[model samples]
Target: MMTTQGGLQPTSNEANMCTNDNGSQLGTRIVDEIMAGKNVFFDLPDKLTGEIWTLKFHCIGAQPGKEIVTVNIDKAYVAFYNVVYIKSKLGYSGRDFLFYKKRCGIDRSRLLALDYIHQEEAMLSDNMDERKISFVLTKDPPSDLEVSITPIKRPRQRTNVDEETIEVSIDAYKEWLAILQHDNPETDLMDDFREDTIKTYKEWLRHQGDLPDILLYERMKNKPEDVDIVEWHYMVLYFGSEKFQKISSRNSENRQKQRTKHIMGYRTFSQISFQQRDPETGIEPTDLSLWMITHCKNDEWSEEASRGIYENAAEKIAEKIYQTEKFYLTREEENAIFQTTFKETTGCKANRLHGHGYLSRYPTRSQVMESKFLEQARATVATNQKNIELESQVQLLNEKLACEVAERERILQEKMQALQEEEEKKDKCLEKK
Candidate 1:
C-alpha cells in the first residue's frame, strides 16, 4: 500500500502477486539470507512486493537467551504496516502485533519520550488488537505481493578470502560504520569512510601494542596510507578510542593535524547528529548512529535525552525481532531482553548518581565491591569491640562488689571482737565491785 506523510499511501498490489511457484521465493530469501546470518540488512524492492510496504532489515544475532535470528522493521515504518496493511486487510485477525510503543519496559518509556515520534504521523493505529503478542510475517501476503531480499555485496571484490580477519556481528559492523561516518562527514558511505576513522582506529590498535596478526597484516602494507573497509571496521569496533588516537607511530606535526581532524569529527558527530539534518542540507549519520551518539553524550541534560534513543535502539533491535522473525524466543527470553535493557539504561543512571553523590568516593566496580565489603567488615569489627568492652566492664563491676563484701565482713568481725572485749571488761568490773 502507498503511504503519505499525514495518511497512508494507498497503492494497488496487483503487479507482484505471487504465482504458485514463486510464492515462497521471497519468504525463502528472508529465511535464507537475513535470518540465516549471511547478511545484516538489504533493501526490499517495491516491484517484487507490489508496494505493500517499503521494507528493510536490521538483523541481530540470536541473543544469549534466544535460539533463532530476528527481523526488525525500521521504527518509522511500523505504523503504516500496523494500520494500513494489517488492519485494513479484513481477512487477517486482530491478534497480530504488539504495538511497539505499548510494550512494557524501561525502553518503552524511552521511545515514548522521543522528539521524533511526537509528530502526528508517528502515532500508531489505535485499532490494533491488544491480545495477540507473537505472530509471523508470511513470505506471501494475501495481497499477492511477493517479497525478496537484495543480497548485500561488499564494495571491493577480493578473489582470495583472508581467513585472518575476525568475523564480526552484522549489527556491530553497521554500528562501527555509522560511528565512522558521523565522525567523518566528508564520506557518505562506509565503503567510502576513510582518513580520520581508519587512522584513529589504527593508532588506537598501535597504542594497545598487541595488534592481532590479521589486523597487523593490513596496516603493514608497503605504503603508510592503505585502507581496508573490513579491517578498519573490525579495529574501530573493538579498539577505537579518542584517548588512544595518538600512538607512538603517529608522533609528528602531520599526525597532530590528523588528530585535530579526528577531534573535530567527534565533536561534530555529538552536536549536530541529533538534529537529523539531511546529508544534502547538513549531515545524516546512519540509522544506528543516533543511538550510538546519544549514548556517548556527556552533558547531563543532553545525556538523558540521548539515552532515550539509546535504549530505544536496544529495544528495537532485541524486542522488535520477536514480532517479525520465524524462530520465536520463549516468553522467558522475551522477559530477559526487557530486564537487560532496564538494567543497562537504569544502571547507567545509577552510576551517574553515585558519581555525583558521596558514593563517588567508591570509584571502580571492584573498588565499589571492596568498599562495601570493607564497610561490612568494619561494622563487624566495631560490634565485636563493643562486646569486648561490655564484658570487661561487667568483670570490673564483679571485682568491686567482691571487694566491698570483704571490707564489710572484716568490719563486722572487728566490731564483734571489740564487743566481746567490752563485755569481758564489764564482767570483770562487776565481779570486782
Candidate 2:
C-alpha cells in the first residue's frame, strides 16, 4: 500500500510499501500511474515525504467516468478531504477521509484542508514560504483556496428617493390646521375657502425654516387661519390662480363650518347657498337659494355670481330727489365730503362698485358728480325759503288798499249829484212867481 511521509495508515487499494531500500519501486509505480492517466499528476518531487512534504491531488481525468478512489497515507495525516468524492476508504477498508480528519486534531476549526491546498502550493513555487504560508494558512483563510470559488460583493446604499408615497387624510388636515395656528398668530384664519386656502397654508409652513419646522409645529399648534397674510407670502407663491377658483366654487356650508371653526376660531367670511332650474324642462319650484357674491368673477359681474345686479337702485332714486331741489345732504356738507378730481376723464366712475355697503353706491363718475350737484341745489332752496314767505305777505296788503280807494270815489259822486238837483228846483220856483 502507498504511504504518506507523516506515518499515517496506508490508503486503501494502494500496494503495501517496502523499506527505504525499495523506494525505487514506489517511484516507478507513481510515474507509470501519471503516464497512464490512472493517477493525477502532482508537481511535488517523488517520495515527497522525506522533508515533511505534502502532495496536492487534482482531479485531472479529461472525461473519466465516476469511480471509487482511495487516498493512501503512511507518514503524515490527510490535511483535507475533497467532498466531491462519493465515498472514501482507508488503507484496509472503505472509510471517508473527512471522518478520519475529524477524529484527528487536523480539522479542529472545522475547516476543510482543501482551503489551504492552492495557496500552499503557490507559496512553494513563488514568494510565499514557510513564514508567509504559516501566517496566511493559520488565519481565517480566503475562499479562493477551495477547489471551487464564489464572487463576493457589498450591499447597495439606501436613499430618500426610494421611499414610498404618503397620502393626506382628513384627520391629517385638521391636525395640520392646529399646527399652523400655534406657530403663526398674526393672520386671519378663515376656513371659508377650504382647498386652495389649506394648500397655501401648508406650503407656507413648509418654507418657514431650513429643515422646516412644519411637522413639529403642526403637531403642536391647533389653528391655521391665525397665520398672517404677509408671513404666508412665500407659501402663497406655490398656489395657482386656478386653485383659488376651485376653492371659491367648492367651499360649501357643511365644509365651511367644520374647517373654519378649527382654522380661524370664527366664521369671518360670508356663506350663501343657492340653486337654479335645469332649463331643460319647465317647473314652478325649480330651484331656490341665496346668492354668494364672493364666487362672482371680478370681470363677469353677471347673474352667475352677482346676486344684487341693481346695487345702485337707491342712488338713482336719490338723484331724482336732487333734480327736484330736495335736500337730503346739504351743498356745503356734500362739497366737503366728496371732492371730485376734474383732471381725469375717469376720476371716479359712478358705475364703480367700490365701497362695501349701500350708502355711497356711486356706480359711475357722472352719477357721483350728479349726487353732489343735487345736494347743492337742495341746500340753496332751503336757505331762500324766507324770501318766498315775504313776497306773499306784500301782495296781500296791496289788494286790500285798492278796494278801499274805489269805495270812497263812489260815495263822493253820489253826494255831488243830489246837490245839483236841489239847486235846479229852487231856480224853477222863483221863475213861476
Candidate 3:
C-alpha cells in the first residue's frame, strides 16, 4: 500500500494502475484501456476525512470508444468536480491537462447519470463543497440510474463592440425583435423587453436632477448591451414622457408601501421552490409555503415578526387545505389567502405581492381622479416654470439688444457733432482768409 498526502492509502494494484508518466502518456494509456473495454478508476483523497475515494469510468460504446470515454469524463468532471482536481489527481499540471484534453478531442455536455450519482454520493457524504468531489463512484453505475442527456442551451454571443457606439437603425431593431419573437413565441417578448429597458431607464433617471425634456432625452448615454441603439433611444423618449413619468411616480409610491422585502438575492422563485420541498417524501411545497420560505428571512423581516406572520399564514393555509381536502393550493387561491391573512394580521395591504399576485390595488374612482388632478397640477406648474425661464431669457436678450442700439445711436450722434464742428472751423478759416 502506498500512502499519499491527505492520509489516502492506495492498494498495490491501484498504485500500479497510475504510473508516474506525464499527462500525454497517461491520457494515451487511459484511451487504450477504454479501447480494450476495461473500466478506468482513480483513487482520490476526500477533503474532509482524508479517506480514499474511488472514481470509476466505463465506456459503454463498443465502436468509437475514445469519443465516448473523452466526452463522458469531460462532462462528469466539468459538472460535478473541478477540472483542476482531476488534473492534479492524475499528476498533471493545468497547462498539460489542457493540451491532453485537446489531444483527446473531448466534447463537454450534460451527464445526467453522473449528476444523479454525484447527488446520491453527496447526500451520503454530507459534503456541501461543490468545488471538490468527496464521494466515491461505484465500479458500475446503477442499472436504474437516469441517463437522460439534455443539451445545455448557450446564450447568443454578444459582440465586444461598445453598445453606445453601435448605431442601430429602426429596421435593425425591428428585425432583432422579430427574431426574438420568432424564437420564443411563448414569451411576451415586447412586455419583458420593455420592463428590462424601463428598469435601466429608472436607474438613469434616479441620478438626474430636474432637467428639461431635450436635455433629459439627450443624456441617455447608458445603453444596455442587449438593447439596440434605436430601441434604447425610443425607450428613453417614452420613459421621459410626461405620461410615463406619472405612471412611474405612481408605481414608485406603490412600491414604497410594501412591508415585506424579500432577502433572496439573485435567486428565482423556482429555485426557492426546490428548497421548500418536504424532507421525507420530497413533495413539492405549495405557492403559499414557497412565499413564506422566500419572505420569512430573519435579515429582512425580524425573526419574531417573520415567525408571527408565518404562523398566521400557515394556520390560514392549513384551514383552507383541510377544507378543500387538498395538500396544495393553486397559485391564485394561495395569493388571495396570503393577501387576506397579511392584511388581517398587519392591518395593511401589501403593495407589491412579489410577483405572486396583482402588484397594487385597483384605485377607487376618487383616488384616480385625485391622482389625475395631481398629475395635471404638476404638469401645469412645470409648464409655468419653463415658460417663466424662457421669458426671462428673452427679456435679458432684448435688454442687451436695446443697450447695443442705444450705444450705437450715441456714437453716431458724437460723430455727427464732431464733423459739424470741423466744417464750421473750416468755414471760419476760409472767411478770415
Candidate 4:
C-alpha cells in the first residue's frame, strides 16, 4: 500500500476504491479510521488465481509486544500467495513485513504459533520493534501507487527414509556424558581416567563393608575415574544384558586371588601358599572368595605415614602385575593390595593391630608362627651383622694384597742394585789392564 508522511488529506477506501491492480492510495486500519478518518481497502488483481500477492502496510510508533491498530478488512482481501510488507510513514526506515496469514491468523488453536510479525523496515529504528509508524494522507487522494508482489517456489516431493536415521537424541547422550563426568570434585580429571584410578577403586572395594552394588555405587559416585572402560565392556558383553552384578570367584582367577589376598594379605596365593575350596561340596572349589581383613590404626598411623604405606603398596602391586601374575583386580582391589600386601610382604614397622598367629601357608610360617615379633627382630639383626662382617673381610683382603705387592717391589730393587755393582767392578778391571 502507498503511504505518505506530509501534506494533503486522502479520502477513505469507500470514497476512493483502489481500481489499479497496483494499490493507488494509502492502506487503512479501523483505529486509523476512528482517529484520522482515513479508509483502508484490500484490492485483488484481475485474472490472478494462483498468482502470488503481497500485503504492505505502514505502522507509526508501534511497540513490539504492544498491538498496533487492528482493522476488519475482507478476509479474502487479506488473501495473497506469499509475502507481506509493512511500510512506516514516519520516515523511510527500510523494507518491512507483516504477519504471514499461515501463522497467527490460521493457527490460533496451536500453542506454538507466531503471535505477530516484525517489519524489516522498523529494524532501522534505534528501538526497532519498540517504535511505531505514523502516516499522512494526500489532498488529491492518490499521492503515490505501488503493488507489493512476491514470488513463490514450488514444494519438492518427499522421501521415505526412516525418522530414526535422521534424528539423534542429544538429551540421552547428554545424560550419559553426565554420568561419565560425575566424580570427586577434589580429584583431577586426568588422574581419574589414568591407570591409577582403577587401582584406587579396587582398594576401596576390598576395604568397603557395604553390599556389592552399594559399594560399587559409592565408589563410582566418589571417583568416576576408577571405572575403566574395558571393565565396563567386559561386564556388559560376558554377563549379558544387565546393569552390574557381583561375579563369583569359583571360575574366576581374579576372585581366587582376591580370596587369597583377603585371608593371607597377598594378591598372589603362591606367595602365601593358601588355597580356597568349595564350601558347598567339601572337596570342590567354592564360588565365593574369602574377604581379607583390614584394620585402621589411629595412634601409630598419621596421614603422611599412611600415604607412604599406600604408595609403596601400590608400587608393589604394580610390580606383581608387571610380572604377569595370572589374575586380575579392580583398581580399588589393587590399592588394597598395596596396603595389605605391603604389610605382609615387607613385614616392616607397620604390623597388624593385634599380633595374629601366622597361617600354615605363610612362607616365614615356622619362624614367624613360633615367635612372630622376636623372630622377625632377630632375622633383621642377623641380616645386618652378616652384611657388616662381609664388608670387613673384603677390606682386610685388599690391605693384605697391597702389602705383598710392596714387598715384591723391594726385593726386585735389591737384585737390580747387586747386578749394577758387578758391572762397575768388571769396568774397573778393564781400566787396570
Candidate 5:
C-alpha cells in the first residue's frame, strides 16, 4: 500500500484483496506492538479469503531541509490501515469515518503532520542518491506517529492466539458513555461488552423505582462479566442515587418548557451556526439569529404562547446593537447582550429557561409586538417557580420514604428476634416436661 494525498492507495497486486481479512486479529496485534514500543513486521493471511499482506513498521530517519525528520512513516501507515480495517468491520463509511477518527483521538492536526512527514520523505527519496541515503533503523520511533487504534473485539472470537486480555482504560469508559448518550444513530458502534453493559444499565434503571432496596443493592453488586468492577460500582451507585434522579427529573422538566425544538437531527449547534453564514458578508449569524432560525417553523415564529416574549427580547437586542456607534458587537458582546436581554425579559437566567442556555440568548424577531408578551413571560416564570417547589416537595417525599423503609426494616428485624426467643422458650418447656 502507498500513502497518497487522499489517504492509503492500494497497489494493483493488492487491489483484489479485501483490507479486512482477519482485521480484528491484525488490528489488535498492531495496536499492542505500537503501545509496547516494539518494531512490528508480520505476514498474515486473510482469515476469510486467504489473501496475504505484509504489515511492517520502518522507523526511518532523514535530514530534510535544516531539521532532522525522524519518523516511523510505516507505523503511521499501518495504524491508518488498522483504522480503515476497524471502520470496515464496524460498517462505518463516508462522513461517519470522520466521527470514528475523532472518537479514536486521531485529529486533523495529527493527520496533517503525518502528511507533511510523508511529503518530506518523498522529497528526500527523490533528491538524495540511493546509495548515500543512509537508512538508519531505530527501535525507538517518534511518539507522534503512534495512533491509538481501538480494534473492535468480536464476541466468541479470540483476539489473539494466546487470548491476551485487553484492559479497558478510563478513556474507553468515557467513550462508551459518549457513544451511549449521543443521539446520533451512526455513533451506535459498540462492541458486545459495551452493548451489554449499556443494556444492563438501562434494565436496572427501568426497574429502579419498583425494586426494593435489597434487590436494587443486589443488582448493583452483581457486576457484569468483562466489566471493570470499580467503574460498574460507581455507575450503579451514582446513577441509581436520589441526587441523579432529581437532576434527570429537572432536566426533563426544562426540556418540556422549551417552546421551539429544532428538526435538525444529529447536527450540532456549531455545525448549524457555521451553516447559517451570510453568503455576501461571509459572517456567521448572531447567536440570537441562529437560535431563532433553528427554532422557527417556515422562517416565522410559530408558537403563539412564547412569540411575544421572543419578539420583545429581539427588539431589546436590536436597540442595544443600534446604540453602539460601531454597529458591530464581538461574539462575546453579542452573547452577553442576548443573555442580559433574556434575563430582563424572562425574569430568570437564560440557563433556567433553556436547559443548555445557549438558545436563550437570542430571540428571532425585530419588532416588539405587545405588553401581553410580558404577561406571558411572567406566567412562564411563575410556572418555573412552581415546578421548582414541586421538585422540592418530591425530594422531601423521597427522603421520608427512605426513612420509612429503614424503620420498617428495623421493626421486621425486632419481630424476627421475638419469634426466635419464643421458639427458644418453647424448646425449654418441651425439655422440662
Candidate 6:
C-alpha cells in the first residue's frame, strides 16, 4: 500500500533524534500550520536547516485525518504503517496563526508554525518568506484543482461587434435612473416628473452627460441584459422627436408614495470591475450585466428583478436634442437625431431600432441539444413510416402474382379436356361406319 505525503514515516523518538542530529529548529507543528493556512508564501529551509515532513496520523483504514503530531526531519514525507504514528492529535484554536504562535512557549516564531485557516490575515504578518502562493481553503476540498483557474482570455466567438451590449443588471438599470435623476433631479424616464412636457425636454436634456452614457443607460434599464447600445440610442432619439409627454395624475401620487426610494444610482468607477477587452482584436464580448430583454416576459417598471422595457426613446430623443442644440426644442430635433452616423443615406434605410440586433432568444447548450434530439426522433419516425408503406406495396404485388399463375393453369386444363372429347367423337363415328 502506498503512503500519503510522499510516503515515508519515522517514529516520534526517531524523528526527534534526527532533528537533533541535523540541528533543525522548527518542529512539525509550525510546518503543519503553514500548510493548512492561507499564507502567501513560506520557505522550507531557514537558518535552521528546516525541511517539512507530513504523514497520515491515527487513520482507521485508508482514511486520512488531521492528527499528524510527529514529523521526521530525515524523511521529507512519512508513510502510514512504516512509522508507528503518534496517538495524540492537535485541534485548531479558533484564533489565527500569529495569535496561536504568541501563546506557544517557543520564541522560534520566524521558524515556527501557525494555523493555516488564518492565512489571508497571516500572510500580512509573514511577509519575509520569499516563495509566494495563493492559499485557497474550502469547507470541502474540490475534486479537481483546475476548478479555480479561469481563462485569462475568452475565445473570439462571443464578440459584441455592434457596440450595443453593456453589462448592467436591473439594479444597475435603476441606478441609471438614479444617475439621470442625480444629473438632473427633474429629468426622469419612468419617474413621474413635475410637468416634463416635450416643451421642457430640451431643458432637461441639456443638463445630462454625453451620448455614450445616455444610450448605454437607456438600453440597460430594459430587463434584457444584452442590447445594441447604438440601436437603442437611435430609437430613443427617434421617439424624442415626437412631442406629447405621458402624464398620469394617479401615478404622480404613487410616485410620491414610493418617495425616491432607490436614489443611489451613480456607481463609482472602482465598482465597474467585471469587464474584459480582448488584447489581440480589441473586440469586447457582450457582457449581459443588464437583465435580458426576454422575448415574451412580463416585467414591471418598478419591480426589482426583471423590470419592464418602457419605450425610453423619448428620453433618448431629448438627449440627442441636448447634444445637438443645448437649450432649443425644434422640429429639426427629429431630423438631427437620425443624422448621426447611422443615417448617411437619404431616407432612413433602417426601420425602427436601425442599429440594434436584439437576439430573439439567447441560445443555451441544453436548448440546442433538445432541438437536435427532436430532429433525430422525427427522422426516425419518418423512416419507419416509409418502411411500412413499402412492405404493404410488396404484399399486394405477391398476391397479384399468385392469382395470375392459378388462372393460367385453369385455362390449360380446359383445353386438354376439349381435345379428349374431340378424339372420342371421331372413334364413335368410325364404329358406325
- The lowest-lDDT stretch of 10 consecutive residues in candidate 6 is 96-105
Give the Å shift of residue 321 in candidate 4: 15
Would you list the clashing residue pairs of candidate 1?
A: 1-52, 2-9, 2-11, 3-9, 4-9
Candidate number with greatest lDDT: 3
Each prediction's whole-model lDDT (CA): 0.41, 0.36, 0.51, 0.38, 0.49, 0.38
The total number of steric clashes, by the backbone 3 Å criterion, in model 4 comes to 30
User: Runs in model 2 with CA error above 4 Å?
Assistant: 1-379, 383-387
69-155: candidate 2 lDDT, tens digit per residue: 223332222222221111121122122222111111222212244333444344343311211111112222344332322222346
Residue 81 of model 1, lDDT score: 34
Clashes of each: 5, 36, 0, 30, 1, 22
Candidate 1 per-residue C-alpha lDDT over 320-358 given as tens digits, one digit per residue, 9 for 90 to 100:
676766746533354345444534544433323211112
lDDT of 4 by residue, 379-413 (tens): 67777888899999999998999999998899999
Q: Candidate 4, overall lDDT?
A: 0.38
**Candidate 2: deviation at residue 75, Å?**
94
Query: What lDDT tens digits, residue by residue, belong to model 6 across residues 157-242?
Result: 86768778777453554465566768877654653464544324433344433444565466546634354444665665554443
TM-score for each of the candidates: 0.20, 0.15, 0.28, 0.19, 0.27, 0.22
- Please identify which of the two predictions, 1 or 6, would achieve the higher lDDT against the true structure: 1
Q: Is candidate 1 or candidate 3 better by lDDT?
A: 3
User: Model 5, range 1-433, lDDT digits (tens) per residue?
Assistant: 4544544444554333323333334445444544444322233323323322232222232122311212222322333334333222222232221211111222221212222323445434331322111121232433553244444344685467677777756455456456555765564434469676666445444544435455567876788977655577777878778899999999999888765556556776667777877553445676577657656767565465345555766777678789999886665466566656656655664353241234433343542233336545766877798899999999999999999999999999999999999999999999999
